[model samples]
Target: MQGRNAGIFRIWKGVTVSQLIDAFERRFYYLRLSITDVCNFRCTYCLPDGYRPQGTRNTGFLTLDEIRRVTRAFAELGTEKVRLTGGEPSLRRDFTEIIAAVRANPAIRTVAVTTNGYRLARGVAAWRDAGLTALNVSVDSLDARQFQAITGQDKFHQVMAGIDAAFEAGFDKVKVNTVLLRDVSDIHLDTFLAWIKPRPLQLRFIELMETGEGNALFRERHVSGELIRQRLEQRGWRCQPRGRTDGPALVFHHEDYRGEIGLIMPYAKDFCASCNRLRVSSMGKLHLCLFGDGGIPLRDLLESDGALEALKTRIAGGLNHKKQTHFLHQGNTGITRNLSYIGG
Candidate 1:
């Protein structure tokens, strides 16, 4: 109903709304929920100038009750993992409350949050106590100066301290997300590889993709994740099998190191074949694909607990319209203005 896929809509109506399976047979079991689109760091690849409000779209973030309703519906549809993402998810005042809401669902096993780690040192312990099961921090570079240059923040040491705090808070391992930028993260591969040698961390290098506002930067510094994969394989890292609710990253493990490596190569062949995650923006719109159009609004249906059935139906119906793959390879970034806009 959201896109120009009337034929699929007809089929969706006839099919049983049991689980989240698209026309291509990809079953979605993971949901990325964006609590807010207000980031603090100005990463060179995303939010270079920091977050800017779009038009009069302020004051539209989903309320706590709405979030609870959304999670309940998804849990009924067999969602096992719920990852809290955002421009900065911690920006929300009720972040801990939101975590408890999602963790309340018995069917939902994983309650993860991907943050910038600015508050992890001071708040990770409390967040852990509030039922947060996993943590992912974005650290583009290990060198303090290089990190500042890429993220436009001088709190590299502070962020690093936050990672230590995460371990102290009882996290088995903290996943680190680093956008692969040419001449930036590429040259410091050894530094990242070495830093993780004895640490309980999973360093994920994500390939930079073109977005509505990052075309020029994408052209200038888009590094191939495939190249990094080759380097890792050559150095004796073995690819590990992914779990049912695991993300797109191809995880690799090395016997010589305590940490693991993950590569998120979006441009790779058959990248979308194993798609199992869906996204919901802070404003309560369901995005079947990260690079999809403006998404299907579900805020109205989320207002009451009575609308749970309708919410599930609408979400299952949207799967029929999900494309087999994103058009990023064809240079089509769709309506995504930036990664922060929809919680990339």
Candidate 2:
């Protein structure tokens, strides 16, 4: 079995593949799957009001079988945690089927989903029953009008209900992912704290990145995680490093509260060194870095005779291309992918 420092090898269906290793020697155990490139709500910083999906059925996106096979391959190659992402992964017509298919691989230990929670309240039970290990709901602001303005949707109540449903459905780990806006963050934080205080969910603040056409507004609206943490500290909330962290978040809990808070500062902090991930776009393109664009297409070979062997070799080659960091340059000038297309 092929292995790397601090990494594990895998055997799926008697096919033993090497551990996932990138050029920087980082061992990868997490795979992020973009099941679809469409969402019901258009968040201002992610996908503006008029943004349309760029996924193409024939080339850009993957079919159910394609996703299943690739996930199996990745699982065999040592992917322990799998997260379903999207424009909104729930937008896929057979969303649960896809999740069930991915979760079917016994080697994949954790199955998580990131969604906007628009349709979650109604469908939360089904997903929870399908072996969903964790749920991350994107709730940017608590202000009704501000929430409506940011998401281009007036279903804030529905989203909140979904969050409640996730907790009620016995999801042990329900995380609230929020993208802080410089102008409205403090006010938003107050509402967020008040709402999250009594809940058992974890609230994670993600530093906003300028992707696609949203770059023009990045400098003005982007609020650093450091500032947010300082604001919380000043308010008598103690922040400390948690002994164990989940994903890329730097998590901490308040001594007085049951719930905790986390920070993912992609721009403000250089976190690429410890990043253990590989991304598969909804259309089947494999991305080594969020900002870089070189991808290995797997559709054609997935049906071949020696497909699994070829896939392992190709994955190793792809790891050699992983960039150390993502540069969030301003506007359409640097990172051209919008949130919807990138499935962030």
Candidate 3:
């Protein structure tokens, strides 16, 4: 807690840290932490493209040491996987420092990040060399015009260039995050497949979920994973599940393609039964549920002299409060921040 003292991470509220479990008996080994709420893209589902960020007094955010401290605490609690996110994590000035700190913890076996890929062309080499393990790049559409319409920018070529750079940098496990909007996300299948069929990366089609905006938009445009799989199957595309057990995605490879593809259909297909993750906000709140009502703030504890035990207490309480699944109980009241604030 104080200067990231080594032995300060001995316990999680006076219990074996690894034993931290939820009401469903789920042991969280993965943590998705937002490094910043700032981003550049204005995708319709996230922020309005080029929207000016709101300035705040507490914008000091978490210093590099503070991130390391909190990450260390979770790592001590059996968090083997940590993924950094933000409005765009690449926008962080200390992105590399944060990655370094995450990797420094020997207990953390894998460190990853999700970004818009605008800066990956230049940043990938640096991050890969810094021991960054994996990446999930957001590219809603492959068609230039559709991409511009979705992100309100003509940087489609630039982002694609960044992906090429990532490939050149040689990270093997890069994947794409495509939010399926009705008219916006259906890129020409032939063109899109041609682009990815030869590459080793996986393209994941995500069902659109309502965040700050209401469900009307989502209901109007959301493309179900079942539909995509059906269309592909109709086209004679064969798939076999890869049986991945580590991440949120359930991936499959095309019968004739070298790369793979997957779907994350939170709305259509429920994967909450096997969920094993905890998400921390950029400002130090422990989010028990990504779409839940609220979180427990840990800034005061992290900054105070006698903070470790208190942090453990709050963290344990947060874990206890973790929902069995989000938006599945009686009278569903969807609670989610804007995609940017929660880290797209």
Candidate 4:
């Protein structure tokens, strides 16, 4: 499938809908929409203290209708790809409906969901029927005990079962996301890769980012992508450049593996220079930067008789103000929002 089209990136600098699509050819018009702030697993890096209020906890989640409206507006502005995320998107009551709504838009070519894979087995087929294009499962560790410890849940088997079911359900591409921690989950990297070798899947290792609730964990345990590649080489895994795609993960193909491995080294190496993503929280806030302090509240505008044209103008303006990069380094003290709220 062709990636997100270029029309999505034409930013209207001013607050006018007429300039939504300028002459610029920005091909990566990908939006990561958070469906909810609640999740089933309380992962160490994501939700530690049981989903406590971070920067703004009282904010309400967008209703299904509201989400559809915003999504439709974005689609009109050339947003060809939309990925539904959440504390866990499956936790949403009408997730299938949401997927269907996104698919109803003719301009949208790809609709993906990134989940913990807890409820995927039961819902993967239904989601596929609803027009989901791909599934990205977050599996940090292959060890059940470590999985429970990392996520604060005992649903490791269920998650694994869900992964298998996704494949059985005919989901064309399945990508496994693994967030690498220095001494915590890094040791199981090779083992996890070995297990997924037979499957037609892409294994991704993400460097831990210092964000809300998990900032402390980031300071304690940090791992770089280079070290991960070296460790894989030590395990007799040979890698080669595997080109680029949507999202900030640098990919590599292993010599004898059935699939590829991706390393997202946001800390050690910053891809924000070419970053082409925008995040809309569950509450309809448009965030230009992942580590940005606040987002423009578009929910109220959309609810208060906001025109689709006006909404497009607002999104364009927000994109123009997008930060070049975020500062999330070791020992750098900065108050940021939680990954759960921003749709990890």
Candidate 5:
């Protein structure tokens, strides 16, 4: 074990691997990997007018091999969960292949995907067969008219059927993401609660975070997730402790309800203290923080399998520079113009 090297500090399956720990002593167990930036639905808070190329030169997304390399490297470093995200991850032609590749890693226990649910009804069974373990579909509203107004799509009923299809496909639970947008989200809170009464859906109300393109709307409609949390508490919903590998949601449970509620409030005090995940853009750049300055390029090391050791070393070394928290409270959205660009 003398040649174990500098970055690596542990051995797994007779191979030297490093733990992805930051200077703040936070260890990462989950990775958010984006495979594409193209999304079909234009969510009002995310990509309002639909996704456009960031600039003139469009450098495509990560290939299957690149995805495999990155996931392998992270798994070696103790990443147990890999969440494939995008403007909509299902948009990729090789999405099932991508899922199988990530799930192929022995160290990775969960292979999750966050999509718009446009393709989930028909394609979810195949995706589940291909090794997708967890699914998060964006359902901004339950009302069809409001859903169209929020997501710029008329596929409300279709997406709902997709959720039903997911359960038929053998998934025990499906997490639904809904961004809390003042009057927009608040108006349908009762409907959301009623819909989850019998199903095992974890309806997560995400606090609207300000991005470069969402500044105007953030001011006009951003609502604190605390408001919902207080109401749930008063209704006899007890707060639940988050698991180590869980996302940044403060989950709550009620004895009478079959489903649970989760609140993701980024602006909450000390919100980043329990951070246990890392993000990589579809273009192969590692984002230490979603709202950080810029990314560290890892694409060069991912070009070939021969650079696997170098890839692991680069990822481990980069963690030393990871900051303690994001600056959303300070009104600095970093280089992210919108959620789709960085796979939010």
Candidate 6:
């Protein structure tokens, strides 16, 4: 009985006997899974044409069971954290069920969801109950008209309500992610900061990257994180460097705010050297780098009743061959999917 209890405890702590063999040597154990390619709102950075791709005879959306199997396999490979991303994760009918399954797995420690916050108002509490630890909502502008203009959807009020609902749902942390463009959302920086000052939520300002379909926009309107910081400093906001986390967001604390701010400088300031994440698209392709084009498709392998140990070997091999840095520096053109397809 004691031995069995110890075994259960070990699994609960993500320290299984099989995990001890390889020692989970991967530098980063974070996994970003795209649950779907469907979204309700067509944000400028996401879907510029306000068009969602439809399924064809050759393409099919991944089922919830398939997602669970892939997630479980990754967990066994020592992925402690899993984030569900999408065209909008909430659009999936079984999103809550998937979250619950991932959370029920003892190997996964953190379960996060990134959304546009459209459905958060009614679904936030249910998602929490289903085992979501944190929520990251994309809100680029505070102005209603500007927000509608950027998202191509006049649902700013719905987004704001979703954010409030997330807070009300007792989420430990809620992050508001904004992609900073040169002259677009940059002007509303102060308004965003002021709004988040009293709340415990964190606001993340992301630099436009060249990986998405909006390559032209990225090249034409790229805004550096340093410039944003400078603008904040001019507003009497002092920033102190915070420690590193899994992703690219560089955190800072403000003097006047109870919350914090994060700068994700993917283009202007690259952190690819310490990059420690692998992205798995909804199609089951394993992407090593955010800027790279190569990915190992695991869907076929899993569907074939392939050996789990062999799958681990493939994952390890993929990580071992991961580029130390992305091709953003050399103008390398190997990338295939955009940020939306890969779930930013």
Among the numbered candidates, top TM-score falls to 5
How far does residue 39 in candidate 3 sit from its true spot (Å)? 1.1
Which regions of candidate 3 fall more than 4 Å away from where they truly are?
Answer: 1-19, 49-56, 233-245, 304-306, 328-335
**Please, what are the lDDT tens digits per residue for candidate 2 over residues 34-124?**
8877777878887776557453444545778887888888887778788999888887878888888889999888899999998899988
Q: Global lDDT for candidate 4? A: 0.76
Give the TM-scores of the predictions, in the order they appear: 0.94, 0.89, 0.87, 0.87, 0.95, 0.86
Winner on lDDT (1 vs 4) = 1
Lowest summed lDDT window (length 10), candidate 3:
1-10
User: Listing every candidate in turn, what is its Cα RMSD in Å to the true structure after a full C-alpha superposition?
Assistant: 4.1, 3.8, 5.3, 5.4, 2.9, 5.8
Candidate 5 on 251-344: residue-level lDDT in tens? 9999888999999999999999999899999999999988999999999998899999889888888888788889998899999889988788
lDDT of 4 by residue, 1-344 (tens): 12322234333663222213322322346789998878878888878767764455565688877887888888877676899998899988799999998899987888999999888989999999999998899988888898899889898999889988988888766999988888766877657777868878888899888775566687788777888878776867655553222777766666677777877887665466656567898878887767776788888667743577678777766655554567676444233556787786
lDDT per residue for candidate 3 within 267-287, as digits (tens), equals 654568768778888888888
Q: Which scores better on lDDT, 1 or 6?
A: 1
In candidate 6, the residue pairs with backbone N, CA or C atoms under 3 Å apart (3 or more residues apart, or in different chains) clash, namely none
lDDT of 6 by residue, 289-337 (tens): 6667667888776664355656666665565456556776565536644
Show where candidate 1 strays beyond 4 Å: 1-18
Runs of candidate 5 exceeding 4 Å displacement: 1-18
lDDT (Cα, tens digit) per residue for candidate 1, span 1-344: 34433112222565423357778767788999999999999988889888898669755799999999999998878888999999999988899999999999988999999999888899899899989999999999888998899888899999999999999999999999999999988888899999999998999999999999999999999989988989999999999999878999999999999999999999999999999899999999999899997699899899788898888888888887889899999899998889999899
Candidate 2 clashes between residue pairs 3 or more apart in a chain or in different chains: 60-283, 61-283
lDDT values for all models: 0.90, 0.77, 0.74, 0.76, 0.89, 0.74
Clashes per candidate (backbone, < 3 Å) = 0, 2, 1, 0, 0, 0
Q: Is candidate 2 or candidate 4 better by lDDT?
A: 2
Predicted structure 2, TM vs. truth: 0.89
